[model samples]
Target: MAATGGSGRSTVADLLAAGMAADGASAVVLDTAPRLTSPWPSWTVGQEAEGLAALPPDRPLTRSHVRHAAALRPGADRPDWHVLTDGRDWHSPPLTLPQAPAAWLQLAAIGGWQCVVADTPHPVTHDLLQSRCAGHIGLTRSWCELPYAVPVLCASATAGGVQALQQAVMALHAEGMPLQRTVAVLVAQTDGRLPAVARAGATMLSARIAAVVHIPHDPHIRAHGLRTVTRLRSRTRHAAGLLFHEVLAAAGASWGTPLPDAPRPAPLAVVSHS
Candidate 1:
């Protein structure tokens, strides 16, 4: 989640989901932003395909239904990491799509996505407030409460951006959100230049969040807008790896009850060195 755009929100979402898929997990990136502006279909084959909006939110969505609706990754099979977003054009008729967090959870549950990375829309602080008041559970809160969900907060690497990000983080903390498991990513829009305020902000934020990682601006991503992640600079990939590791460390715990027994060392050989 991010306070605003240009925060690398979509980039972060794509990286996490794609990385998980490459690691053999069933991952899906859910686009919650407006259809017209969403980047999910930017370079994939989903530009003109039926997407999340086409699925019948009122009825159960099967794997086949989801696969048919999604925009598959490049060189990926049906079951590989897919992106679910809008497929409408300017002339297309209006469509009804689910926006509530619960609705998305249901979709993910039915689709059986082992990992869901959502690229949310603007004004996340407002969303956090809306979901907390008057007995409402907004998308932000619901996703935060997902079992073992590690939230990745993004902000541009700038003074103004970091200040705004700090405010958003404060709001989330006031809402009792999990800062311990959350990771903050400072996305450098310019290469080899990070503002002093952003650096200081990261230092302060490090005390409150799980980890703070910096993503160097990749000229390729800037030019292509996540058209393909394979061409990312090695440094960018390394930073993404750090973000992934921090999230995994935060999730290091049993899934639930009936937990499998912890591995015990085999009894030492009883031959007594015989």
Candidate 2:
């Protein structure tokens, strides 16, 4: 989509800012709903773009719209927003991926932080992440996959933003500390700047990552202001939010319901005991 669209689909940069603001992005879960889905049943990219464009400019960009949009007119047009595919995973408030370098990561853990990985496979991103950690701890050569326990952030499918994305990936790596569980968040913010390093990095790490998230510099961009694109940004945010919720749910679903441990006998036959 054009950075400044006449049809008003809103560029990636606009969407990122608006979505972040409307949702009140916070350290934890941002209170916003960005649509999140998979490409199941295989809907054409053109069809998906139209569905996203169809949303009204003033729409609240809530969870309901996400559901409604998924159930579009053409039955086959329904978006695969729920299923968790191996593709890029998106989230609000962002998350990092692939445990940060061992040493830095340990420091972060002491500070109560953990690393979350976005499914970015950009060579630069990979190099950056790997540099921090050094030696494949668990990273794979497969399709944009990250180590287990890491979260993924999804961005627009457009290829133009690849450069900026590379920068984001590198930034995360640069900021990451070893031994700490870092959260690697990825998103496709179309208009944001991709540092020189990022561009170079992409050449080194292409098709290895799912996407990159170029964090907005100004909150006003994300807020409901003159520069914001309401509908598009909202939709993007909804998708991200849904992904976040899904990740949390999956983690919770793993272990079976907690069975009450047999009441521990008072210290196993405590003798005389004062």
Candidate 3:
């Protein structure tokens, strides 16, 4: 009965929801800005400025606004603030993670009390997965996942491409992105690019990350991808649960908590994502 935190849009939320469902718990998703912000189509310059003004002072918000606001700097095209609040004259300061109900919900949902929390701030969709380890709850020592945040330079691929991917990951890491956030990378298999990514990732992120999966490229395989997507999604989720259990076991070894090996859950359907 412990809680953990994660940061993201749909990806983290989706995975968290799946985890909550699997564990029969609840998930409270927090947005970076007020929920009443403008829709995607209305995300123009003036529109965003207006949207910022329209943000609610106390409601949860998404990080999109902050990222966008930062983008509007001298050489930027937009701003990047999760939620914009009124200045000196406003009723409240601004919305932030601490103000969001998700934190409390996670605490209540897990053990009926506060326990653990995780977050990552990368803009392209990525987060730290380490903070979710089950055994670290209420522990005095916190495990850092720095290597997982580093890029394992691949020789087969263009330095620029690998660098870009690495930059994206680093951005997420520096931004305090959640650990469970999944990153998508395009690799040239014949060139050993996948291995490079894995090797580098393993070397740099071994302590924080669990495993690196290589998904084959198959164009025709996507014909019925939605179903497969659903299945693979389930598989990854179960894998996460397994990871949680492993953490618990490790923690038990030192804390005398007497962790038990939970029964393996049924395999999820595998779908082709070409």
Candidate 4:
């Protein structure tokens, strides 16, 4: 979850999912943003594919539905990560997006993918302020509480962003969220020196979380959207790699010893082969 808008939430999500897939981990990205604004589920299996709206939670989720709703086109070589998001066009009137609980219900049906990288809406801290406490914990809480979930909290490496993140961390701690297993990321806006607030924020917040990672500014990402993983600079990639390692370590801490891979039925090839 992110504390503010433009906090590199999607950038982190893409990096984690793509990195996992490149390492042969079964991973998928769930984009919890609207089609008009989201950068995921760029395309689907067919022109008529309706993304998550087509894969309703009323029926059990299957590997076929998972792939069909994903961004992949038919017969395309499976890329490192697959995206699931609202695929509807701009002309269409907006439909009510699924809440985190409903999205989690749909997630429970899928059998294969080992990791789900969720790129959620912005200003989660703001939302909590307006929402009911107990009922609104939603995916932010559900996914974190999982046996092997690794929560990565994001905020822009700015003074306001740091303050927002601190508020969120304190609120989550109050709500019994797993701060120990959480990884905090500060997305830097420039290659120049980080603000005193950013540095001090990291120092102040270090004791409350697993570890903090800072992503250096990448000109490529600023010019173009986060599409090609190779475009990331060496330093940026290094940060991503470190972030991935922290995520793995945190997830490992959740389950202690690694769990054996669950057996799969023949029909579901690698959790619905692309």
The global C-alpha lDDT for each of the candidates, from Candidate 1 onward, is 0.74, 0.31, 0.30, 0.71
What is the overall TM-score of model 3 with all chains considered together? 0.32
lDDT digits (tens) for residues 209-231 of candidate 3 = 33223333223222432112233
Q: Give the alpha carbon lDDT tens digit for every residue of 37-92 in model 1.
A: 77775656435558866796655456678777878665232135778887666456
lDDT of 4 by residue, 176-251 (tens): 7888889999998888877899999999988999889898889998887664555568777677668877888776
Candidates 1 and 2 compared: the better one by lDDT is 1
Q: Candidate 2's residue-wise lDDT over 230-272, tens digit each? A: 2334444564444444343433343222312212112123346
Which residue pairs clash within candidate 4? none
Backbone clash tally (model 3): 45
Instruction: Please rank every candidate by TM-score, starting with the best.
Output: 1, 4, 3, 2
Query: Among these predicted structures, which one has the highest TM-score?
Result: 1
Among all windows of ten consecutive residues in candidate 1, which has the lowest summed lDDT?
259-268
Q: Report how far off residue 94 is in candidate 4 (Å).
A: 2.7
Candidate order by lDDT, decreasing, is 1, 4, 2, 3
